[model samples]
Target: MQTRSLWEHTLTFFPQFLAALKEHAPRDATVAVIGASDGKFVLPLAAAGYRVIAVERDPLALHGGEVHLPGTAHAHATGLIDRLRLEDLYDRVQVVEQDFLGSEPLDRLCDAVWTSCSWHYSVNHRRPLAEFVARMQLLVRADGLFGAEFMMPVEARHHLVDHYTSPEKLSRHFTGAWNVLLTLRTAEFTERAHHGRLQDHTHRMGLLLAARTSDHPHPHGKKNA
Candidate 1:
């Protein structure tokens, strides 16, 4: 049986991003997945012949372990690494176990980078949204793809946090050497209860796909024109 992620059923714009990546990046390109949970996106990238860097911090999410299921149920869930091995894709993926924000720079720049609804978690809110975006951006090589699907403001509290943002607002960060390729947003929608969230909830999501047009120095490092 194919191993599935806890978020397998969640709505996402990842398919669109993947299609774009295939068009822009070479078949053998290296792609990095930020907050890669249980190999959802990582597996597909690897299976498509792309070398993947899977960055995830949660032990249970990275390596197999028993866990509580939806309600009053428990199961031994297959984690990202085991899943990759199961499908013979392990060789194509390098699992990096660390908190993405606090982790040191990746060993090498990637041809493309993607993150899905990762930075909106309560734990991540402590850091400014710009930090999360800048970190993801830094991982991409020049002329590479940068894709992120984020939670837009839904709850009253969400409105107060900049991390819960729309595509238009998020696009501001992709200036200078970056070119915005696509921006998409979803209307408020209901999602069924899942592992971590045991109650059904409503959410709005936004996707921003951009490409680095040139290798420009970091804003702070740039010399005066």
Candidate 2:
């Protein structure tokens, strides 16, 4: 999906997202964005004065996808960054291609972890639900912000988002160790397949912002040791 469309259809509360990062994450902290396909969100974020590290598994995400972005044929990930001169920004947005479910974990912890519409993939590919939480714990530290936007019926995280979406149900996951900050159940959308596509689709969505509690058990951000 095009980044612009993703922003319009799903990411409605950009303000809350900013607040989460500013309040929970440290100043000049690095933001690790899961599913950072083609710097769609990364470029704007980097320009906003935060260091960004985009992680994507799709090979095309690094370069460009099969379908070029509007107004250009070489509208790949890195190409967009270079074109917009976002490359001049410090910390130089970095995009890494790796499976989030692989045996290896990230080498470093982040001040904020941004996973937009990508959590379902972890649930589908990775085994137990606890494993998914454990992985996040290791990658994110106490007081760090964890943001997500996904479809409803995340109880199993098995399939992709289609019609089932309940913010009330999804908000339950942010309790206990996590402090649920913002849970806005935005309007349902009939999104399109892609740029210039007339195919409309309906999806249930939940936007969320949560922070790991200070007494969140694990000191180093990993549990079940």
Best by TM-score: 1
How far in Å is the alpha carbon of 33 misplaced in model 2? Answer: 0.2
| Model 1, span 1-225: residue lDDT tens | 377877789898989999999889888999999999998799988988999999999999998788876776788889998999899999999999999888786756778999999999888988999999998888887778999999999889989999999999999999998999999999999999887888888999999999988667544432211
Q: Candidate 1 versus the native: TM-score?
A: 0.93
Error at 17, model 2, angstroms: 0.7
lDDT of 2 by residue, 193-220 (tens): 5543435556556777778787866445
Worst 10 residues of 1 by lDDT: 216-225
Question: Could you tell me which 10 consecutive residues in candidate 2 have the lowest summed lDDT?
Answer: 1-10
Those runs of model 2 whose alpha carbons end farther than 4 Å from true positions after fitting are 1-11, 68-86, 121-130, 153-165, 193-198, 217-225
Residue pairs whose backbone atoms clash in candidate 1: none
Give lDDT for model 2.
0.61
